[model samples]
Target: MKLTVLGYLGGYPSHGGGTSSYLLESNGFKLLIDFGSGALLSLEKVTDPLTIDAMILTHYHNDHIADVGVMQYYWQLHAERPKEAVLPIYGHREDIQHFDSLEWSGATQKVAYKPEEKLNLGPYQITFMKTHHPVTAYALRILEIKTGKILVFTADSAYFDGLIDICQDADLLITDTNFFANKVGQKWHMTTFETGRLASQANVKRLLLSHLPEIADQDRLVQETIQALNKPIQVQTAKTRLAIEI
Candidate 1:
């Protein structure tokens, strides 16, 4: 099993085209986390564009869903005909409707898979927990059933109670650390210190931080977060094009 960091940022780049998207591959089954701004460009760097099985939207944010049209068109133009029959897109009901209206230049089918409370997708037994965000955001706990890899992706949320339990024992806790410690309350995103505390309390095996807003100082945030948390949790910033075997 492996997790590839495609575009690793909370917001769009100044020059554009960096992936906030992520791809998870296990036993040749591929699933995408969120399709942020640079999704198509990043996916092309990893595997054949047609091999993508499905996409899971964390929320309705543009940075997370902007590339949906582009990807659909790519698959329609390329890929074998049989593989392009239809694509399963899993997300909240609102998110599904939002993207379906797009005029994608693709001769493919779009299938929407709503949570309907919770459901199992292949090896992933997933449950969408409530999160603190302006929109209807969800915290996803994906269990890689065969290897017992527990991953928690708290898609773009402000810190909230019970978050520790939601992320407890996670093999990898991919939290949204969109700002520095003192930069809390600037918006709905979590501060660095807050993310560190959550990872420590959750006892995650490894903590990979992402969704970084460009205006903060990365060095100071890492140092301060390490000191505040005081745990051996592997806290590190995510980089684009980096792949980690989980």
Candidate 2:
């Protein structure tokens, strides 16, 4: 399986940056994780929108779901045929309004899932775990059944022990490190320090930082996180076209 960073920022994009969105593809099957602000622009550059097999949402924040409407528009206007246009969207029941609204528009179909249920999408096996966030949020664990490789994504969350267990030795961990350590509070997101600490404890092979806020110097933030880590771990700032193998 391969992971691609389509958009990496949160809240709103940083200066011209995009909000939370990612694309994953394996064995000719494609899936979109989140379609946030600026996602459509970035997506159009990478691949045909119609090729997306399905989409999933971790939460209902506008920063996360902002592009869902436009995606529907793309299908409605550009689809070569009508029957293949509806993209299946999997979101929790907690965000009933977002699902209902999209389903009613005929742009996407609502697929229901529960915590800890393993969903089979071709060779990809996905599982969800509820996370600590202001709204209903979930963390994803997607495993390629044939390769036995797993990728974990903490869509958005505050510091919590459950995240540590969910990330255990994952091939790659995508985390929301939205603020600097000293400046962050646990009300919504985790600081980069806690982000690094989780990677250290979970023994993740690589750490990909996402949901970033504007910083004067990104390298400084990287250094700060490295210092707090118990052991050296590979760290990369999420960026468009950046791809990782699972």
| lDDT of the candidates, in the order given | 0.77, 0.85
**Candidate 2, overall lDDT?**
0.85
Give every collision pair in model 2. none
Worst 10 residues of 2 by lDDT: 98-107
Task: Tell me the tens digit of each residue's lDDT in model 2 across 1-246.
Answer: 999888888798776778899999999888999899888888888888888999888988989989988887887776474764678888888767776755734567888777668889767998888888889999998888989898999989998988998889889999998878787334588888989999999999999988888653578668767877898899878876688887
Per-prediction backbone clash count: 3, 0
Off by over 4 Å in 2: 82-85, 104-106, 184-186
The best candidate by lDDT is 2
lDDT of 2 at 18: 83
TM-score to true structure, per model:
0.90, 0.95
lDDT score of residue 114 within candidate 2: 75
Per-residue lDDT of 104 in model 2? 31
Candidate 1 lDDT by residue in tens digits, 87-202 = 66676766546756433444434445455456677667777787888888888888888988888898889998678988998999888888787773456888888898998888
How close to the true structure is residue 53 of candidate 1, measured as C-alpha lDDT?
A: 72
